[model samples]
Target: MKAAREARSAAVVINAGSRRGAASTELAVDAMRRAGVPVRSVHPVKSGTELFQTLRRVVADGHDLVVVGGGDGTMTSAAGLLAGTDIMLGVLPLGTANDFARTLEIPGGLTEACAVIADGKVVDVDLGWANGEPFLNVASVGLSVGVTEALSPRLKRRIGSLAYGIATMQAYARHKPFRARLEFPEGDHEPMELEDVLQVAVGNGRHYGGGNIVSPMAGIDDHTLDIYAILAAPLREHVKIARLLKDGSFIEHDRVYHLATRRVRLVTEPPLSVNLDGEIAAVTPADFSVQRNAVHVIVPQSSNSASFEGPSRH
Candidate 1:
């Protein structure tokens, strides 16, 4: 199939704290100008509402593409607004994790990302929703949620992925699993009452939290969500799982349960914490579904040919 037209007029939105946001915007603007593509507007947003408003303004002004400069959170926020719309979404990876970009095989630097956008080649990608919010990468609950929530921005910037490692250690120290009832689209119900569950991750893209392949077999073009339930195991086993995840071998580990479905209902007894994309959304008893081909994304040709490995902990 022929790719969609590259936008001649684009709106660039950046999340200020994204590691490379400012530089990426500069690079993109320069590239667009070089290609003779007019930049309709540039918005640097501080909060989620501002981001949404900026997107609305850009769409209202008839901008053909929305180029986002930030990490997974910013991309996920933009995807929620532009999905099912004619406006194509382009990404400039400035965030720490940049999970969506990795899944699309978009290079890490701003210049390369700008070149991809200038080259066009838009394709439809699947999006996942948890309680009505769109998530382009992964939504996780349980231990991962607690760890991410407990982490401070200072820790993340100063130590990078090590922040997650520290937080994971702290969380595991207090680890306890609750009873959960999982309902699948096919009317099958599985009740799990365990003493230890590390986390449950629902993946729209194969990766999240700075390149962890939480769902190795996930495909963005496919209309399905890959689910992983990381059970609590011995500390040594957890260490082994973490190591395997880094090398893309965690999916086959004995402690992890993997499933793929379009919809899942999760009900937990004590209400576990939930993380959507990288941000905390809510506690348990959450409903999730996959919206097939819900958004048009600009991706490198390599993304279409690449296979994904499941997520791992840093």
Candidate 2:
């Protein structure tokens, strides 16, 4: 226990703007201290830009581990700073969706999450890149981008993950079909084009959009990104596809196109907004690639989604 406690020194950063952070911050800090993990600092950040800067400072100050408490977007913002370094990233999952946390099998509760960090099992995982930014879950355009743009913070705090569904419905009503071309750029695959594409989601991990599984077999350690593109079809057909997606069987649908590749470039007619792990990452005419084993994360030993490789010492 003493060896594990001394394995990595940690600093905690809680995004105070997250829905549950205010309620869970004290509890999380207490749980970590009780489990004997040495916490060097605690920071409460108000925005993604602030969180990113704070994370860089924490790493620079010699802390080898950073326990970030927020939703997927906040965590992904930190990944841009922590990627390729030897720092061990720890998650607290105090957000509305926590989609990336679901991918990691990190517990939703503060106590269990803090306990996982205390256990100190580290594993290297793949990262999805969209126009040079690193993301742990999905990078998407079309309908999901509209959803991110329409989703309000008040609604999110009131209804949590259901806020995504509400915003999605509204986005769908206003969504327009657009031409999309997908190219391998680096992988061994031919280019593909679609006439009317409603949405394109490239997933590095299994889940996105508040628990929707973009690909059933996708994993952060798999070294590939799974692409799910929703082709424009009749409303009835879309309803059927939506049912399959809700059932976690969207892969079997015909109108949905799936690809697993090392790198991809997407060109859309008239440029669209792209959401990465729930935040607006970039605009369309974008490039994406997989950074295999780019970041190390702390997870529980029992987590099937991520296997424990060993301890990380920087």
Candidate 3:
């Protein structure tokens, strides 16, 4: 295994509320230690508020690396605090979906993930912003907000990734068409307005919605955001697009408008909720942009989703 130049001193934070978090907290620390990581501190948080405080505390403590465990929502919180800093992040995927971890090619198992953190290379990755709040995966409007609302903790813990499908079905039946105005500040594309839209999403990383590809060309280190808006269509056509979402071919359909840009301003007709990662964190008229190379993350050496810019690239 290649040696990482990042400091061995690290702190760990895990959201005990996540699906596998409570059971794996002790295991994660032990694995990291066994893998030769010099863990300095640990925090097991149970709520978003507690997580926020714990991350802030860890950042304030001046540790060179912080190992975070949880899903997309949990990782997003760490990103906001660690962005634009030298504090490297080690990931342990312990939540449902774990889309953020998937984008980085981090393994899902506890021991294997710790091995990556111990021996992986560090790289810079982009983060998406919504009204100044940082998000790791996708920030979405309309239908996704409904899906987030429908995805109760119980449902996720019981059925795992299948929860996304069941929640989508529930949200789909109650979905309402809305309108959105899109403007690109970089002048990459002309401003446009669309009506009867099912959802509008801006993706910072590739995989989301339990491993659904954002777009065929998407990458977390690409320094661009992938934007897409799905307009309502006839029943048969809508079903076809839905079937293609897993691989991001949904963007090829006429009803699905897609683009890649540095920044975009979205204005909704009635100011609907925005789901950032998995949390309802912002509301439209929200501004979305890519924070290029904003996070220093450790990934498996064999992973290619992001560029190897950290020490020990060879």
lDDT of 2 at 26: 80
TM-score for candidate 2: 0.94
Against the true structure, what is each candidate's TM-score? 0.90, 0.94, 0.96
The C-alpha stretches of model 1 lying farther than 4 A from their native spots are: 1-5, 188-195, 305-314
Backbone clashes, each candidate: 6, 0, 0
The sequence of per-residue lDDT tens digits that candidate 1 reaches over residues 1-314 is: 22424466778898877666655566678886676556778888777778778877877887778888887888888888777776778788887778788888899877777777777577777778888878888888887776876677677667766677788888778767766667786664454454456778888887777777865567786778888787877789888888876445687889888878888988777787778888887667888888776777777765672322222111
| Cα lDDT, all candidates | 0.75, 0.82, 0.90
lDDT tens readout by residue for model 3, 233-276: 88788889889989999999999999999999999998899999
Select the stronger candidate by lDDT from 1 and 3.
3
Model 2: residues with Cα > 4 Å off, grouped in runs: 1-6, 246-248, 308-314
Clash pairs detected, candidate 1: 71-95, 213-310, 213-311, 214-311, 216-309, 216-310
- Model 3 bad stretches (over 4 Å): 1-5, 309-314
Identify the candidate with maximal lDDT. 3
Error of 2 at 219 (Å): 0.9
lDDT of 2 by residue, 93-134 (tens): 998989888888889998999998888577777778889877
Cα deviation at 130, candidate 2, in Å, is 0.9
